[model samples]
Target: MTTGAEPDHGFAWPDVLCAPVRSLPEHSRLWVALSGGLDSVLLLHLAAFCHRSRVDVHAIHVNHQLQPNANETEAFCRTQCAALGIPLVVRRVSVNIGQAGGNLGGVEEAAREARYAVFEEILGPGDLLLLAHHADDQVETVLFRLIRGSGVAGLAGMPRARPLAAGQLVRPLLELERAELEHWAREAGIEWVEDPSNADQGYDRNYLRHTIIPGLKARWPGLARRVRHSAGACADSEFLNERLAERQWTECSKGSRALSVPALQALTVVEQKNLVRWWARKRGFRPPVVSDWSQVMHDLLEAAEDREPELREEGFRLRRFQGWIHLVPEQPEVPVSPVTLLPGEPLHWAYWTLTLESVANPESPSRPIRVSTRQGGERVRFRPEGSSKSLKNWFQEQAVPPWERACLPLVFAGSGDAGELIAIGDLWCSEQYSGGAPAAGWRLVVRRECD
Candidate 1:
């Protein structure tokens, strides 16, 4: 049933919720992100009346702390949820305006990031996240991306349904218009707050909505419907492109971070960019900007064999080393100073957790040796009596990239930078000092960090 007057008895909230519930799982938690606005108010009310046998319904309100009416907005959400007999989850999030937390793009973008971060956290495996984005919002998004020079990926606009984190996010009301929701709101006698900032044309989306979209719609009636159609076409194209890219991505992928440069170079430039973008997506990072793709193609792969070019953005560095282009987080400079590592203890350093252990060796070096980054020129043998090799040679032999070698944790037997090397970055434990055997298990494990 449509949420419009075209229905025989006019628009109804229960009708709205029941239709969308068909797309949702029969047994899962249903969370509506309610902002106490007209769109969300309508959605929340409708969700409260949804069939409880199919899914449990809930509401979430994120307080960005940006507006002066933040407390009132949250309080309104709580009151409304209470009246509807639905539990509300209110999260108060800090919107940083200070130096470190300030907008890398714009304040709107920063607030959006903070809001989505909270949304992703509240969702668990198979949970359904229902958003109140409507047709007008979809038009605004498509226009914003178009004016900002987006490709098919960006032009695809907000999907009606997509998987985010471990849960599924569905925008059930995307087919409905804000005016229709408002009309229903008035008939239902539901109160909703109007965000004052929505009127401020200073924001890009607001500018497009108030100025550009209106002018365009005046010139071309049903512009929103046309734009929505275009977005659907773009989404279809992206789906097909992703299917092809996934195959190429699997073939060119070397490990978690590295891609086979030769394999990438063999593909057409478009496919290469698609594969790289897909790789970035797999790593939960944004793909490279369209503006940077040409330079990346020329410098990273097409350049001379000896040339090592890199591009860094979004905390990840896409660089070419040896025979591959690797996508790894931009690492801090390897610590020049030595850090003490006590046996059977873990030390956190540079996006990694380094743990060291030692056996009860009577003839071996004492416990609590110092650890530092690889400084080159260091020598170590697998066994105390085995032949020694430079740390550089050993790293090369182990296929560790030069950039990675410096960051691998190096454990020493003594204090200061001059300490004798005992354990090398969770890879090797020196023979004589080897936490030998299962009985004398001295080992170090370097864990890749997620947080």
Candidate 2:
């Protein structure tokens, strides 16, 4: 066990709570993410000691089941909270860490997902979730992201506060060192659980904390503090990047959801790349390498307007159509068939399907039409008096996006082999076929759309 003499002018529990609470609302309920560790124990104790009136404190402990003593850790947290007269919420989460990515990243990410899920469930609207991450953790996180070739945003490490589902998550001790939390816990006679995994060198974080950080600290005793400052600078730089990205998005975006091709092409190459990266990030897509962005931009901007340009990277497809770029799934292409629909059955398409049923006739002439992909040299005869037109030419006339033209499901009439193509969904229909009057005749009814 490590022990140290208390500092003379150190900011204690009351001082920490009072400083942050002056800005918060009067009836804010703060839930501490207590992991039965020194940092969290100290945080919980501090929250209880101060702000007991205006703030309601609750402790949440998540059992990841990675360690054998996870149960003991939960019991210790419960006991500690009970002694402090604070309510304790224990959540046991089982994670299949091996199936995610089988690395430390996978394990940590799965555990974190489970932990946050429980935290969100316990917290109500406007309640705050307080985490116990400290300055040393922030420094280590920045180093880790740097080694992994992260961008400025990732190298900034964790934010002090962020909005979550139920409320906001705040890291109060982000300015405090880890050693200070241990010192405070010891001074208050608080017992904390020690997980053996923290010392295990197999994990990258443990290796950094136990081996790399100690070596660096030996050379420069304030290395963690310096790295924390560096992280703050990186965060400021990232904020500028974000602001520029937002501005680019405003200039380049078409609708509320997508970017306009002409607007995107008008920008410089660097601005175009930034706009694409920003758009991907905003749409919840993972950031890819510079090479990936290069290919996407080249395909989107340099490819021929009539050609369907698609580039697949990192489980997403950037596709170019008639003056537009759409992000879609990079899943295996499933072949859909143009077949006559039977009652109470579903027809499968690229990502969605259509179901047919019997229904009464409405105001307009309701028609049963077989929708299918446009076949080469296929001509649809509208009515006995109207002239026949090529399906491809008709699609172009309707201004349908070029990429979707070939994949549109074709609908026909009658059974297996004796069906004539009638109507294509949102494209064209044979004027010869009409659901006139619905008197015992086959009426095509769109049932449900499936993905």
Candidate 3:
């Protein structure tokens, strides 16, 4: 860690500037996201001088390794934190530039995602991560979203505080303008590194910051405050949209994981779209982005009964099965050929796990048990001495989705055509293989992942 000029304790800070940092939400520890920039450097000083005595104050610097002087900036952050007697953690991340074509927007987004991932990983309960996003940054963000055709949620701008991982992320300087923060930093004799990329107008944000915002500021003079008000209005609208979606979800849902097709068809197209987006977000997945929602909704809601229509998204898909729409996660590949299920060992198949355990004073099975996916002609015997039914017929009777039937594990007591299907995934198990005392003297336990 290198040393720098310490903050001037004698310089009096304005009450408006200090109030945001002083009146933080209840937290056990405070962390400053130090970027070695003017805004972040000033934020670190404010956090130290205002809350260091009351709570544990620390700093984290994420090195994106994008610019030529990335290492120098990281070193500067270390030096500043060391001078203030605050612990600093430096995380170096490799930003993937494969998606960044000729522009810097992709790189910016990738670095932001990586930085937030680090923050999410380090934050714990009662920890508050302080960001240095000022009013100027908010204006840029809102304008950028507007240019990109973003919805109300995107136009709402960065929140003042929100839950991140197990902790909270707070931007105390969001109400302060960039010029205000820089003026105070220079007044207190603080030092910071100037990133060279900020000067390049090649990046979209840089172009906005240097070319557009300056002119807007000169023309309006109160552009930041006006933008803040508009952003606040958008935020309010987005909140109401979320609440409306929640209520509509409760009305149309068939169960906790699915929606009723008939119930959804009764609602307006806009409501349907909003509910689906809200559901995907609630399940921790990005919402599906389609060129036309009306056509998608029509196919899902009004398609023929024989046709299995579905909307696929990242991580999960929404499929109309029977009378309900099920949100199913993409299952992993299962073994195509027969695999021996040894006693006391758990076998993982797709999203399901199969385990065979021997009962007390149990007798050995008549033959080796194995597990595999359905191989066309298959039979399942619910009883040891009763009649057997075809696997296809049983699945149809149970109303199991076709996509799921292809991956469900078929556990058998023997091999080939003579094999007796003892268990069907986690849905069914033969009496001989289940219960307190089985004819085979063993228990076949099957479990499916919750995700």
Candidates ranked by lDDT, best first? 3, 1, 2
Off by over 4 Å in 3: 1-9, 52-55, 335-349, 352-371, 383-386, 410-423, 429-451
Pairs in steric clash, model 2: 370-410, 370-411, 370-412, 371-409, 371-410, 371-411, 372-409, 372-410, 372-411
TM-score of 3: 0.86
lDDT for each residue of candidate 2 in 187-271, tens digit (9 for 90 to 100):
6566777886787788888888888888988899998779877888888987887898898777666443456788887777777
Stretches of candidate 2 exceeding 4 Å from the true structure: 1-18, 21-28, 52-55, 329-451
Error (Å) of candidate 3 at residue 405 is 1.4
Total backbone clashes of model 2?
A: 9
Off by over 4 Å in 1: 1-14, 26-28, 53-55, 98-105, 215-222, 254-256, 290-292, 333-347, 355-366, 412-423, 426-437, 448-451
Query: In candidate 1, which residue pairs clash?
Result: 382-431, 383-431, 384-432, 435-442
On lDDT, who's better, 2 or 3?
A: 3
The 0-to-1 C-alpha lDDT of every candidate, in the order given, reads 0.76, 0.70, 0.87
lDDT of 3 by residue, 158-200 (tens): 9999999999999999988988887777777778888898899
